[model samples]
Target: MRTRSLTSAAVSAALGAALLAAPAYAADGVPPGQNPAATETTNVTAGSTPTADTPTGVPSGVPSDAPSATATPSESPAGDPSPDPSSSAPAEGTGAPVFGNVGSDPSDAGFLTVAVSSDSAITEVSAKLTQRHGAEPATVAVSGFTLVSGTPLDGVWRSPRMSQLPSFGSYDVTVSARDSDGDDTSASGVTTVDVEPKPVFADRSISPAVLDVEHTHVKLSGRISLFDPISGETSPLGGKELGVSAQYGYSAVTAADGSYAIDVAPRLNGENATSVAVSLSFWIANPDGTNTYVLVDSKTLPVVISPSRIRLDHSSVRIKYGVKASSSGVVEYLYGGTWRPAKGVAVDMGYYAKATSSAAGRFTLTYPYLLSGDTSFTVGTSLDSYLDDPYLTASHAQFKVDVINRTSICFCTSWLDAYSDLHIQGSMNGSDGKVPPNRKLYLQQSADGKSGWKSLGWFTVKSNGTFNLDAYVSVPKGYWRLYSAGSSDYQPGNSNSVHFNRTATRITGFNAGPEPVRKGRTVTTTGTVQKLSGTKWAAFGKQRVYILFQAKGKKSWTQLGSVKTDTHGHFTARFTAKQDGTWVGVYLASGSYVDAESYRDYVDVR
Candidate 1:
């Protein structure tokens, strides 16, 4: 038993005060054994018990009335078994006694001490406590009852290891021990403790800091920071409340590391934009029974939406398709007045037209759509782009398509009826006179294989004859052919159709421009053209003419005079110089089909 000694006078005074203070007790004089005798007193022997009269009284010594501290257990009333004011031993048959201090902070591993004592030998002992807040129930080894006389047995008890320790609270502990005779003794106590707050943190950076929309998915990511001191060990913060809001409804929660992610696909229709924010918060308990919360540092990142540059190999409608990305920002394109997929349309062969954005741009889109007829496209970096003040750029084109007529001869009225009124502007080239200039010419096959004829239609043709023929050729479903017609009407007899399968178009008239020379000088020069004449040379609309001039240096050609034949397709130029000297004569031809090729002739201007 834990004990403290009190001065005799102090003990007497305390007893008097206790009896007076207790509402149920009305005391007169103090009891015995507690006070010193008036003369030198002798200690009470083991067998000799204190008498009812002794030197016990208040300081006044007038035998003041008070409760008696020295009373026999049998002297107590029949029902009341209260101990003598202060008794060292338990009631005669109270059984083996168990004692211990209440444990605390059980959320963490902690020690519990239990001591047992008994008048007789003890048999069984046990400690009883429920596992609360995810802790396992303590084992029997930590809780047992059985004691022997004078054998101060101490039990080392440990609070169970817990998966999740609750906040600071009260917990009860009861220890029960039994003596050899099967008599039970028990003691109970309470311990109040506070579990340490679990380490926590919050996200403090921008979400989707780098927006990417070209892939039809906006990749989102952010930074989460920890305010607590975290080392090698990390605690999971699952189930934390995390919120992310965009121009449209899009939200999500943080994962174990306080990091959160979500995707937002901007509406490709009308306007394309991205505007959003993210927030997070959670709670931890305080020692004083109050709750504290941690909040994420909210951040807003501006989303950029780029205009889609649906590029192609050529701007003409019938041209082959090519792909290229646009500048940064969200953008939408329209097809037949409705929004098109980021990928515009499929052209000839497996090639496709698509609206693409630069890096870090965002766009919401769907799949495989069109871009035809008076369609409109819009692009904006802000959310309110759909209003009347939308940012958009639009244009229009037309096409005049025809069927390919496959035939070797021009079998007009007898073989096939010529169809011509398929006209749409700005997309197809029109024919005038002999042949269209570098325009696509499509042909249709004749129904009768023997006829072997093809006709012209609208399409795209480069100056070099290479083309993405946008023209449609309706044939009678037989063997057909495609080819290029050389320069038309040069002399009315130029090779009109050079079948692609037969051979490449011949460089008919590779020549130079008109020569220039001074008027007073006499100059003579000659120029030549390759493949100048055909079956009807004079009938060809384009005629070859050459001029002569006095050439000063590699780049200098002065004009004198130019000449041409009378429907014979030959020409010559003359010049007269006031001063006589050696002069250079350059030759110039009217019709040429070559890149930077010219002929030069030496002359004397004497």
Candidate 2:
């Protein structure tokens, strides 16, 4: 047979076709009439310089249908061998190509990436997207994958932009990779497409918008709806459970009209919290039987607590030194522009007294005896841990009370002799049951019991709260009283008033002359009346003197006549000397002055 000459173009075309049509492994061990052992050696020898008898095309001993033994493009003498456009065999490895990372790009929603690794060069990479519906699954092929970098056998592949995918649904994705050896591997995964409407809250309100002790429970009501992003439309969503979170966690289900109402009790978690936050959460069931939570809409509400108020019946009180002081009031809290009783609350009254409020918010506090002066006190509400809900602000009110000291005086005029010192004794005591030593006390004199008082002297109080005073008297009579100037612990005090009289007077120079003269003749008796003035005798004007006569053997004296004293205090009287009797002159007492008398003289009537 004449040998046929084949050009390089024909040779390349034939090999490319054979590589496309042949499988990686035949059903039989090797092709008929092909030697498996010398396959490598034959291909190496044919690649050498062509002889005159052999052409540059096919080797002499190789069949036209057999595949080339060159594994890589560098080993082939025809430079790089063109791969078949249709199909290729799998790379020599333990299994098909291994798929690495396969997912959609987060930066570009429509772009998908697939990473595959193989022992030999990879020819193609593609993904199959099957959308899920009610029953049947619709599938669509996504090709046009380009290798990212490096060799195709171990690199990432990206698909073309496919942004028209539906949202709010699930998609089944299968990525396949083929190597230079026509070996194919596929990995299956699920991709979620969420473009559905989101739940929204509208016209939300919190009942009892402000929190107080009375309104601890808050009612939250709102209308829940869904917002469609594609159509820009909103509709009510019913029969869905929503979570409400604040100081406490609560849940509520929407009604058929998409309305929901929930109640929650919120308290102050810290000492100084002005506001609190309440959040609403919505969730939906995913296609893969999993649930997803979404924060559709959240609102921050203000938390305002009412303040406590303390009211007292009396702002100030006056009490005796030994009497107890008392105060009463009502405790209330401000809520909704009204004041309500704050029951079961503790109150701190000044002076270390404490009380609990009654059901009517009434409380009473009793204080011990205070000092003599005004004392300031305060009453306030105490914080209670049990009543944390509807917290109330602390409030207080101030008041004052006064205590007075008691003083007394006693005196006896029977022991007060003429021209003798006046004695006075008394006791001073405080209602507080304390004896104030070294306290100054004043002795006062008043003409009238009510006004025009004059201070006589001052004396210090003893440790036993008793006082005694001995005062020399100059004036005959006056009204006297004891006074005490109060200290910081006690108020001013005064004792009962008294009147004293100690006046002395005498009549001198009395003579009944013409002794024993004619029995029927008239006798004149003269005497001068005087008063004691600071140990000295002074003329006593406007005084009446009585003249008396007594028989020598008689036991009583008889008045002969009465006489009036002149400016010199001398008195004259005319009387008949009947028998031998004693003659005497006397002055009667009047208005704190003592009676005065003259010595008796003997007169004989013959």
Candidate 3:
């Protein structure tokens, strides 16, 4: 703590109700485990009046017996003044000040008064306090004096706090006045101020000088200063009957060492106080049993409580590629005490993702949930921003994500078994390490060398990342492939290409029966049409085959009889062997497939 020092002699005097004698803050210069710079001299000296005019710096409208306010530097001193202390007489004409009877000054007692001048012409009037004890005289200002009602003469001067002087000495005082033209005169009061040391609080302190509004009590500790002016001795005023009051309701009594504790419930601060300074003024009860109080020293303590914010790691992304982090951080703010976790604080995901704060104010968030085909996305918001916490204000954070397209391979068989049902199988995944489950996979076909891929059919993807489609090859194409129409969390993809080409129908067996037949005799022909699946020829059923006959010397052959293959794919035809030389069986080509012919087997007739 710092003290207010007076330059020259120090005298003891108090102003009216303002406690003008209230001392400037003082220090023993050392506290428990701490050292401070030199303290200022707490001295207040009485006046040696100004020759030109009283130093007009006092604030206006004081208690009775103080000076009537003269013109301030801003207001002209031409019209307002008290003509007589007894009546409400306004002054006339701008003129020099007049002086009257001089009263006793500081040397005689602690209080003094005088008769001075006031008129329409007077600008500013005051009593200036000057000390003459040292080599050079120094002045200390004592303001807020009230004019005595008896008569208007000289204005009295006093300090606002009524604190006692820092040092003991005699003080000479006088009255002075000035007019608009700056002319002035001064007269000395007969009385002089006699100052003496008074006991007070020398070493005092408040624990945790800075505090939170929630603090319920303050710890006050101190030892009173005891000095005897007559005996020239000093001691501690222990076991004193001192007391501290808060707003005249709550108070605490001093212990043996003058230490005390004060309850601070419902803190004495403004409504919106984040940080505030409150004065704890010290006083003691009068020993006269009159229940009156006497002034002491005052110490100011600062009391506080501040809002929260979130810091983000990543701020942008793309949807087709799949985003990595929706939120890379957490909400940090003032809570139980200093800044720490705003744990469990929910962060809003505006069509992007979900998030919540954890330890050390951290949160994890993933993106693109149930939101597809987004060109631009602003999401992962910190709804904590709307909390509007007074100690920690609200803040928000977000990330931007987008969607795009990519290339993927669809799996299909190189050779299609037209006999069996045509089925395609494949898998789906993304670059961001996302293997989407329970998704749809489509089978598509394209023209030989051109045209867009048309979807044939679709199937659901299994948990193992694979999917299959069993579909009939109804509308065949030269090339085929698979597709994945992306979901909200993944991008669209494709599979490797393929084609649908039916294999040729083969002849497994063929025979011409009834060797050496006579004319008009019936001859039977038989054959089997088959398809190779793996290493075995499987029957090609439900198809027609032909038995042909050619005359011995003719190139063209005639169709003797037509027969359809049975379940085993075997066909037989009977015809009259009319001058027949040899017979052959033929199979025809159908949609997107080649045909097969049987080897000639000769049968002769006579």
Candidate 4:
């Protein structure tokens, strides 16, 4: 092989000294010409005459400079710039040595290259294999290649250029050729074409850290970059897949430019505060049997769920009533697509109990269990459903009456009559103690079974216990029961029922007056009246007939007349209304008979 090395010059110097010491000669022992071996460029032609520089008795008996007598110019020819005494021909070798540029096997031959691009496109390939085998110089075989491994080689198997194999890996190429004896030889070489895996965006994030439990809406935004191990450039991660998920299994994808965003909301079933982390991954493969995947190289974002801002207030105009709750733990209602506080608002003691000072708008809700009317309240909190397991809700809270009753009265009088006045006062109490102030009180009483129970009046309780009532009656002679009705300040249904009786001494009958007569028309009115006897109507009994009457345009009237009556000596009348307006008539017992109070009358006219 006509090869050149850095040490070739020194070897030439030593060759000259050997040539001077020994006489160059053939086996014939003749003197060999000492002219430095001249390199002759020859177009050696078979059967042609040798050139002038051709030497006799050389190997193959063909001079080294004889190109006209050599194979065609297309054939590979050896060259020698100089010859010394040390230069000698082979000692009659046996047969031609194996000499083609290729691998060990005929089937193992091809080419390997690499691909590089700004966006995953192949860019360049290796300069064809320049290594040599024996005297024949090797080349990136363009044809006649076979694959002992990797891609199969055919008549025209193509080499993997720098572009085709964009990923990193090892590539094998084989080239085969045939010698004069018709023996096929092949050679293969490995090339490493590595294409790095770029970075991909995993997910996005939001500012202000955690998402509070009461927080409904949140803003989403973040950045992404290619995670290339080989280079730190921000390469495009187009067509890549990404995911973002939270405690409730919420997830999102990235854009072509590696940017990603997502909105985290409460699950269909509401929850508590939570913190979530985002992640990313990238994958790539190479021709040399190598692969890679990067984790979180681009960017890591976080999602925070803040607590919900729940405001509970009294739904009723009157704040004196109790409220009812719908749910338990982490109670919430859907408001404007987000979770809010439950209805029937009430003070949450668990929250207020915390040492953290409550803000101005902060208030507690006291749910009504037994009180009348609608009332409730709510407060603001900072917590997310995700972080905490069983979130704060109606079920988790304990509800009780907010306002306690404190004012009540209980008094017993020694002397009581129609002419005497009575005064009574006191304060109310709860299971604990005297209830809070500002509550109202009421008084109720039932007259001797005749008038029944009736509400006297309502009054506000003052710091001092003082209240008065006039006990004057037209005919005072009966029993009475007194009590109070409940309110925000007072509990309905009195705890105790008080009773009292008046002296019995009534035995006088009024005059049997004339019946009412119309203005211009004559109307006859007659009746039998009763006499009050010892707190009872004794003269008013069976066997008596009485006519009661009232004048037109009058609210009060009396018994007109009476007769010895019914089964004994009964009486009747013919009455007429001379004018329009209202009137009343009654027929009662005039003689001795008990409980005869049935005949009552009423009349109206236009």
Candidate 5:
């Protein structure tokens, strides 16, 4: 066989120059080391290869005069090795194979080359590749090696062509050989491979970068590319997928031109704006027809949202106690320079009342008027999940509602001594079943009960809603009513009107003759007529007074005669006393005074 030299130094120098000044590239968009152009076997020599211990063309770090180490199986039991057709039965007294330099291909990491020599004729050769560190150890078998050296017993071997290894890390390489003597020999060593330095993203952009209520979804677009280490050139990479880290199960595949566009809906979690992460990835096709997912590049994006507002129909209201009141309004959000309804949101109406908005964003809050004062009603909503999107900020509206209590007065009258003050009593109350202390009430009188009303006196209310007053009236009779002026929290009210009659007179110090008057004898009766004037009784002049007599056995008194009072208010009348009876003087009813009567005096008959 013709011999050929492998220039390992030239390959190492070329690879180092390319890697020293490599530019930073996006790792998520392209599968490193799996490029078809980089996997070709053009740089490698075929057939009749020289031994690693040869004086010429020796790999770096391996001494040409170094003695080969004998290959031996490890003491620990190993997994089953791949079956090879070039194996032969074992023979006794045959020495194990010796291993020369063993290493990976520098130009392409897909091939493994080794030098092996045995005392007996060699039959089979294989290599086992195992990952050095991982959660689970990964192992691959590489077989069908071709002999490229002097003889079957001592020769150089090369494994079949392959794509780049799946991962970038240290690997344990075990080269095993079987000879015609049925002897097995193996040697283990470590090798490492790095991912290719290449740019993955040529250009990237996002549409509607700032999100708001009007724009809830974002469009991500970008182009993928690959860098060639040998030529330092970039080209488009197709068949890649783009994804958003914030959105699960969302992805878009790139086109033939390495361009991709995808729409993603992200949640702000009730914040005004949020950041999201997006990534690019591609599937790498392996020599075994399986595919592997590799991430190339990632980026962060920002989003924003609009605020919300609450509207009310009325800013203030007036209501009576025990009555129900309602307030209506709508909830809206700022979107695209317009106000849009925020439906199906929970709103808090003041006083612990809550309501849910309708499809039109309208809501009505109802509550009973239980207080007799001004109350503030605040309706609002906060940042929470509602409708298609959550409101980013809190909003509210305020208004005032005045609740007035209904008032009433129970009025009545009582008669006291004619010489004493007049009496009037009543109870004042409200619909809330409470009487405000020190509430002022007025006693009013009207001539016709419809017009010309005048206040007679004013009184203060008690805690129990009751009041009374002794008022002197100069007018004989008039229409009377109780009135109460309203406060900021209570309603004005009036009691029923009443007609009063006050004109009346009385007689005092009356006498009927001396010695008990004999029967058939003349008797005299005298008295004074008095009337109430300014809370005091005074003598009245020119008033008509009547004198009457009643028999002792009669249940009624007979009117004997009438008399007129002198200017001094004194009146006298003489009459024959013919029976044992009581005699008394009376004043008949008149337009100004109702009537007057005197004390009775008895006469004994002879």
Candidate 6:
């Protein structure tokens, strides 16, 4: 029985190869663990593999503790370099077990894997997992290594995983092997559960989700729970900095109970008040540099300025944008209820009035294009979904600022899929607040805007300014916009664009084990759909996953069957191999995620 570390100086001196920090990887396509005591360079004679039942002595660079991802594996200062295992005389006449790769899988978080091979019949192999937390230290056993291929003594082992670790530190791992002859030998190594502090926040709401632009700052307060939701582990984030930001930023302190409040200033992208999108991001940050809140909610918000901040003299084409701001470009002013960027693809603006502020909070639009003369005035609108400034609230108001001879058409959209017609609806209005009779609105779609828009269907404006039409849309996978080519006096126009994104999930770690399975024997196929949960791969469970197999004679991959992932985000299926081929899993996009294909797992059936 002996234990030692593997130092670069020693490995290089013996093997003549650069002995860098080589981390042994595990499952999810990572090779199984390796025996620490096993020499990197072997001198066994010929094809007849041989082994020693006992250690020659301790070797170089065995750390006193387990290896950590954050901490480099360092050699013990007291460790004395010794000759390679080949130089030591065997302590026993019986051939020892030749251990295979023994390492931990980074994806699995805190699991170590060991595969062993031996010259003699292997009776048993054991792995010890040690965790030290302050004065209290604990240990556990890694299980599920199935012997595949060759004799039981000289077989390949895979699919070994570790249990939930008790602490957040390094794990010392030691693997021992006993042969049928009752001879024993062991290999020692260390691994760690040093994962980044994962932050998962619970939902919280502000006192008033809506506000007025006149208010410089609005109170944004919420309760948060920092923890690994899937792991059911609570993360203590008592004193981390939390912030909400858009064009501007604000900060707050997380209370001991995960509560925090900050006054955030909402900065709109335009001059006249419009609905602004605001987000509270990285509300909490971990010491490991991990943060949460990937997709912040840009809910219904309006930062619209009342009394129509934009004074437009249509005859002279003079536009004065006035808003009270410490600086210009601080808030986006909107003349129309919605602010449509003038530079969108194939965008034909009948009337566009939107600008940010200047140092004096005054904006004058001298742009020659604003005078196209189609409407009396424009209302301010949100740039995207919500306002970034806390002071801004949500508004949808159409106003007239000047007396001008004008013809205009404006509309909104809605989807009705539950019915057979697949009907889409919209309401059009003019500057006079009257519905124009016999107006025509066409539905056009574009996969990419560069390719000219294609008309799908047309809707005749109703007497009430409403239009209804049903278009056979299989999936709303592309952008759809309403098109008005313009009637006698009205100008050509396109409505706001809409894109329905198909959600998708990603799959990884598709593995078929008992690597070398015999023909006609069933091998366990295990895998995971590696979904990101606050920067770490968390198991997405209770979802339908398809098992696909492609054999030599098969023309295409056929669905063998399906399986659901466990709470731990793992799925397993068993199949008897008739011949050698490949196995794969297809995870159909569930709610929130789109469809994904797992990495191909090749099964070698002998």
Structural similarity to truth (TM-score) of each candidate: 0.23, 0.31, 0.24, 0.30, 0.39, 0.27
TM-score of model number 2? 0.31
Tens digits of lDDT, candidate 1, 459-498? 4445543333223335322333333342331111111121
Worst 10 residues of 6 by lDDT: 42-51
lDDT of 6 by residue, 427-515 (tens): 66543455544367887778864456888878777788776666776556555667776544344556644443333245566787677
Best by lDDT: 2
Identify the runs in model 6 with alpha carbons over 4 angstroms from their true place.
1-95, 131-166, 190-606
Local distance difference test, each candidate = 0.31, 0.59, 0.47, 0.32, 0.58, 0.46
Task: Judge candidate 4 against the unseen true structure and give its global Cα lDDT, from 0 to 1.
Answer: 0.32
C-alpha RMSD of candidate 3: 28.8
Q: Which is the better candidate, 2 or 5, if ranked by lDDT?
A: 2
Considering TM-score, which of the candidate structures 2 and 3 is the better prediction for this target? Answer: 2
Off by over 4 Å in 5: 1-34, 37-125, 130-141, 146-171, 176-187, 192-211, 214-272, 276-301, 367-369, 383-391, 408-465, 469-606
Answer with 2 or 6, whichever has the higher lDDT: 2
For model 5, residues 35-120, the per-residue Cα lDDT tens digits are 21122212221111123443322222211110001111111212211111122212335455555445543333344555556567
Ranking the candidates on TM-score from highest down gives 5, 2, 4, 6, 3, 1
Off by over 4 Å in 2: 1-187, 190-205, 208-217, 222-244, 247-261, 269-272, 280-297, 303-311, 319-324, 329-347, 351-374, 381-395, 403-433, 436-461, 465-606
List model 2 lDDT by residue over 229-300, tens digit each: 333344677888887777777788889878878888766676567666666656666444544455433445
Q: Provide the clashing-pair count of each candidate structure.
A: 61, 20, 51, 92, 12, 51
- Kindly report which residue stretches of model 3 are placed more than 4 angstroms away from their true locations once superposed: 1-202, 205-275, 281-311, 317-326, 329-398, 401-606
Give one digit per residue, the lDDT tens place, for model 3 in 1-606: 111222222112111111111111113211122111111112221222122343322212211111111100111112112222222212644334454433322211233333444343444444544554656655554444444322232232222221333344545555455545455655443234544333434345655555542343555555554333323334554555544443233455566554454555334433354443323433222222212123343445554543566777767665454234354676776646677766655665554466667756677766534233344433333343442232334466656656553434335223356554555555565544346643677767777525787887777777666666567766654666667777665667766454446664555457786887888888888889886576466898877888777786576778877789999899888888778466777776477543555655557677
Residue 394 accuracy (lDDT) in model 2: 77
